[model samples]
Target: MTNEELKKAALDYHEFPRPGKLGIEITKGFSTPEELSLAYTPGVAEPVLAIQANPEDAYRYTAKGNLVAVISNGTAVLGLGDCGALAGKPVMEGKAVLFKKFADIDVFDIEVDAKEPKDFIDTVARIAPTFGGINLEDIAAPSCFEIEDALIERLDIPVFHDDQHGTAIVLCAGLINALELVGKKIEDVRIVCLGAGAAGIASMRLAVDLGARRENMLLVDRKGVIHRDRDDFSKLNKEKLEFASAASAERRSLAGALAGADVFIGVSGPGLMKPEWLMLMAENPLIFALSNPVPEILPEAAWSVRKDLIMATGRSDYPNQVNNVLCFPFIFRGALDVRARTINSAMKVAAVKAIAELAKQPVPQEVLAAYRKNSLSFGPDYIIPKPIDPRLRDIVAPAVARAAVDSGAARLPYPAHYPV
Candidate 1:
């Protein structure tokens, strides 16, 4: 859609529906004044007292158990960098609506006017007690890494920057299925990430953590491939170097990194990779050009040389869209259910494996007609499961929660319905 048409639709779409997608609703029957009084004023005070006495009871007394804060400073909204706080509200609101609709999780999107890292961190930390978790969205990289680290360190609740880990987890899951289709092993694969931003770094880390050998991965930034040669680096860049450090120093440029690489992950920017780059890759290449609005390399452009390529993009119009929406909701649901203190690497790996396994399951009859496959078996085009797929929340959540429990991040004991 054109920019003007998109804006007009966004502005006019929420007309006469109580301003937007969400509205407060009474969960219990309290029609009479007496019932209302008991539910609201005097009787509600009792529950408040009880919660105050035992702070853990607040989950029982309030919506804190299932609500998340979609907090942002609007500095890094989806592909539109540095749009400021007010401008980011619509996207944040849309995210909250998605959280609610997809996982039955309530979301309050707070766009802080403050741009400074310290200010943003301070504001969200103070207000974090109100929700089960914090979903930090659309903040720029480097800063996003710091914010998430600080928040996770400071708060007991699960704090996730969806741009980083969410996208990474889903991307890894897609890679798992993609690699399987091509008869490749994770440890043996040479992967080159085009962007050294949040998603790129996180994807590399998750891939490494999930058994992709450190020497097999190479990350590229604006200054070309991130390597020991580059002196100017952020703290996050240092962390990335720990992974790429052991790789042969021979790999410097994007072309050097792409030589015989099995997977190409593009979180960088548009047109960073040419079709020639795809042709240079190992046979049965897996390419995820995940830049929004436009990918690093267009699918048709890449596919011209290698029809055998397993390709994906950030755009939903494509067959395998590597969007974070598939990961965050299910991850949060599992974390919340288990009262996970943090969503750690173990939990993320479990999520990736679960999602990969789910995609391989037999496609239900209802879905079979749409794809026209005899069995909803996984392959190149069906690597990661779609966000709208009903089985996702049910499948991924329990696995994450289980991992949380196993990893000692869970505040609660194992549930009776643990597998569920």
Candidate 2:
């Protein structure tokens, strides 16, 4: 479709359907007067009194266990960048749709107008009791780190920043499969990351937790490689400072850092990676040019430069799409099911492993039909499970819940429905 046509279709999709992507639906019937009394006045009071007496009864009496609040400040709406909270409503609604459709989790998309991190954090914490889990979306870096940290510490519920850890989980999953294809170990590989924002920092940190060495990774922001000798080292945030590399005169630029690197993961903007730069990397390099709509380098362009390269992107047209949808819904499903205190590293790692393992299994007929492909297998071309794969809910959710229970982050035992 033409760009104009695509734009029109998207606008029409949201506008024609009641001017938004989401709507409220009453799960229980209340058509008759008797049903109404039982649904609201008398029956509702019983649950309210029960919850008042025992705070934990809210989960049993209300919809809180199945509900998620997808909150955002609109400061970082995808690649749009700081469009403000009101303008980010559509994306938040789309997230709600994903939650409901993928994992049967209900969501309320909240667009908070608070510009200050503390205010946003406070607002979410104050209203935490109404929902089972909170999924933070599209908040900017540095502040996002602080907001998520404070909220996680303050709230007993599972609080997660999907832009950071969700992207990290899926990225790490694909990377795990990609490394296997290329015969490279995460600890031994020389990694060059081209974005030092939320996704970049989080993905790199999670990679470290999964056995990648901190010293072996090079993190580059817009200014250049985040090296120790940089005069602005003090200006770096705590998260960014953890990955700062020792100053090397030869490794000041991205091109310099890419030299002999085994992997290149780009969360930066378009056209930042040149085709010729692919040659500077080690043989059989893995390139994840994950900038959306348009990647740092196009897949075809990268593949033409190096046939030995294993590439993935944030776009669906390409193979090995590192989509966050693969993480958040299932993660929340598992968290809510197990009543996890927080979506911790162990749960995230379980998600990573589950997604990675799913890709290695034979592609089911249903999945192939959805993609309209006759064949797909575990190879460089197919390193991650498709978002539409039906098995994701069952596979990822249980793994995450088990991890939460094992890690002591969960408040309840695993649900019988999700048996071991």
| Candidate achieving the largest lDDT | 2
Error in Å for residue 118 of model 1:
1.2
Weakest ten-residue segment in model 2 by summed lDDT: 243-252
Quote the lDDT for 275 in model 1.
85
- Which candidate number maximizes TM-score? 2
RMSD of each: 2.3, 1.0
Query: TM-score of the candidate numbered 2?
Result: 0.98
Provide the lDDT at 10 for model 2: 94
Q: Per-residue alpha-carbon lDDT of model 1 for 1-420, expressed as tens digits?
A: 999999898788875556766666767888899988889998899989998899999899889999899999999988889999988988898898888887899988899988788999999999998999999999987788888899999999999999999999999999989998999999999989888888988999999897898777887877667666566645445556665553455677788788899999999888989888777789999999998889999988988889889999988777787878788898999999989999999999999999889888876776656555466457777787766777888888889999999999999976777564
TM-score of each: 0.93, 0.98
Query: Which parts of model 2 are misplaced by more than 4 Å?
Result: none
Residue 398 miss distance in model 2 (angstroms): 0.4
